[model samples]
Target: MTKSPYFPQPAVASNVAITTEAIDITTLFANAQHATAGGIVLFSGTVRNHHAGMAVAYLEYEAFEPLALKQMQLIVNEACSKWSLSHAHCTHRIGKLAIGDSAIVVITAHAHRSQAYEANQYIMDRVKAEVPIWKNEFFTDGSSAWGNNTPPINSK
Candidate 1:
């Protein structure tokens, strides 16, 4: 059987992938679980039907897969080190995606729930701000444009 593009071997804890297929959130959760893990957090970023009051038709994502995966791995490694995580896995979907589809998933396991939650959020933020993935939004008005990464208004 062919291995998932995300995790080629079971020995490694950090897993990252840039795929065209739908993300398997269950597999990511399982991969993030470890013997010493007391808590697990999973985050899924889904495509929505509306953006800035405009009706979104869909989204198209493109990335330099090699560079994207490398940057993702770096984010996971940083989160693991900062939180003393037991395991971490993340996957980002590329290509065309419909509304309500999961575009990305991040799973983190740690000895504490707080650590798991914080690390999961941190990893996602870094992925959004630092990863090379680019998203183009198609609006119902027959217009499309590339999306930019803007920090949340409350971001510190």
Candidate 2:
């Protein structure tokens, strides 16, 4: 995908991140606050304890970081353009994650609650559908598999 003209420079691109460390939700919420924003929404996707009737031990995420970041930024930018958003950001964690650990976070700020909520969902849906991230699920039965056996992106 082509770069967005509205994309922030690398130094200021804290809005989208991929990390092996734990995601700092407090900092992300603080950063998403805007003077005119009356509504702020944050969504955290956490690793659950079970999947497909199997007891999950843990999960590992991997991504093509360069493309993942780019796709995440694009999703955020699209949300901003589609709504009256004051701020938007997304961070996804990589490497191993235990049950109940946050895997992804999406935060959005808007002048109204409905816009904030809708934009937040839109960003997440697009991220899950378009980003080049992969998940591996490890079961308590000593078995593991790639999540859904597929990557999110189709490489169109």
Candidate 3:
């Protein structure tokens, strides 16, 4: 059996797409913190300039609102089932965003480092893969690519 100092229990999750303020990371950490064990992992995705060799000047994000939120909830449910994560939360951003802007954030906690690490990866992978978010990549030459940004249908 794996040895973890703490055990992941239940968690509180939130899903939102906003154009304003960056995620309050401190709050997310506090939500995942538990007195049971130790370790907490936080993952953040940002808008970067360059995807698949395209000189991305900027990125515009959009979500199918209702479906997108539902899919995000599904991701959380999957993470809970797969990991001993005590708590988890995620947020995604939409609208116009320049390079360096925060795109998403996920925080997971467990009793040990490995659990935290694994769960963190699981959450990010699932969110990117399953959530029906869309991204438009604007190139420096004024070209753009638009399509579903979902990561994949399955991950083990």
Best by TM-score: 2
Candidates 2 and 3 compared by TM-score, better number: 2
Instruction: Give a tens-digit lDDT track for model 3, residues 1-156.
Output: 884545455554533343346677777667666776478888888887777666889888887778878787777767766775676677888888889988888877767778778877987887777777778888899888784443334412
State TM-scores per candidate: 0.86, 0.86, 0.79
- Between candidates 1 and 2, the lDDT winner: 2
Candidate 2 lDDT (Cα, whole model)?
0.85
Question: Per-residue alpha-carbon lDDT of model 1 for 39-123, expressed as tens digits?
Answer: 8899999999987777999999999888889999988988877777778888999999999999999988877799889989999
Lowest lDDT block of 10, candidate 3: 147-156
Predict model 1's lDDT versus the native: 0.84
- Total clashing pairs for each candidate: 0, 0, 6
Winner by lDDT: 2
1 or 2, which is superior by TM-score?
A: 2
Model 1: lDDT of residue 24: 80
Q: Which stretches of candidate 1 lie over 4 Å from their true place?
A: 1-12, 149-156
Off by over 4 Å in 2: 1-14, 150-156
Model 3 TM-score, 2 decimals: 0.79
